[model samples]
Target: MLDAHLVKNLPDFKIDVNIKSAKGEVIVLFGSSGSGKTTCLDMIAGLVHPDSGHIRMGENTYFSSNQKPFPAEKRNVGYVMQDYALFPHMTADRNVQYGMKSVGKSEKSLALLDQFGIRHLRNAYPHEMSGGEKQRTAIARALAAEPNLLLLDEPLSALDDKARHDALTVITDIQRDLDIPIIMVTHNWTEAEKVATSIYKIEKGRLI
Candidate 1:
């Protein structure tokens, strides 16, 4: 399980939320842009620090205001950003292996590519692939690290309807098979309804 009591002070508002998520659950933070949805994910992932409170995931303490914070890499989180942040110079397969340190990295990368149905695009660069393919590659890259939790920020916003539907299916299957908590941020209520096992609505930094 993941538990957090977080607070981050912004100029105009404060992000203060008490969040708990069970294993094998899909939790969606639903809100409009600038509503602190992504900021919450960033804090959980250790990309941004919370001014106060703490975050605990399973046996790990991810963050604490009084102690040293776990860096983003050590947090054991698989974060797929809004832009599908694939390395422009690396091939799809390479992107997946970027965070992998095990000797079986190649095999794992190939397996993830195949699992995401993008094995054929393994050698293709980000610029050459379609948006859906890029998204798949990004997700596969994130999972390659064998993270304890998955964080998705506006994952399907750039895809067409058909591609969006397909991506949703793939993500759901991954969550089920991995048995990990997934926290996704999205403004689309339809997408939230489709994937969220638990939903939190945020407005002006407060959970509603």
Candidate 2:
């Protein structure tokens, strides 16, 4: 579960969000390019600190104004970014293994790769793989840690139409197989429909 009510004051604008997600639920967040959807997810991932309010994952209180802030590394959150941030120099398998809290290339990690249909591409570098393949590798990397919450921020936006559709399939499988709460941020309603169980639309820094 995720419960967050955060407020961040910006020079040009402000962001305020109060949202919750239950276990096994995929909540997709849609908004314009400058909307705070990605910032909200960043707060949940502990990458961005809220000036006030609280954040909780399951029974754990990760962030609260009254308590100590949890370090980003200790938050145990899986994050897939918009650029699909794979290392250009590393092979897909190695890229997936890098910086994961969960050690070893266990059966579980391999199983996730297999489910994403990227098992064969493991030996290939990010430069050698197609757009869809690199995106899947990034997903595998995020899931490898068995995070408490998975945050995907417009991960398929760079892909073409066909690749975007294909990424949706992998996203769906990950949500079902992991049974963890997923908060996905996107501007594309079509992709959101394909990947999300419930929808949340953001406008002017508020859920609309």
Tell me, by TM-score, which candidate is best: 1
Tens digits of lDDT, candidate 2, 1-208: 7898988876667888898898888999999988888888888888889999999887788899999889999888999988888888888777877756555665666776787888888789888888888788998898887788889989888898899878887778777777789999999888888878889899867788
TM-score of 1: 0.98
* Runs of candidate 1 exceeding 4 Å displacement: none
- Minimum summed lDDT over a 10-residue window in model 1 is located at 170-179
User: Over the full model, what C-alpha lDDT does candidate 2 score relative to the true structure?
Assistant: 0.85
- Candidate 2, residue 89: CA error in Å? 3.1
- Candidate 1 scores a C-alpha RMSD against the true structure in Å of 0.9
TM-score against truth, every candidate? 0.98, 0.92
Alpha-carbon RMSD, each predicted model:
0.9, 1.7
Error of 2 at 175 (Å): 2.0
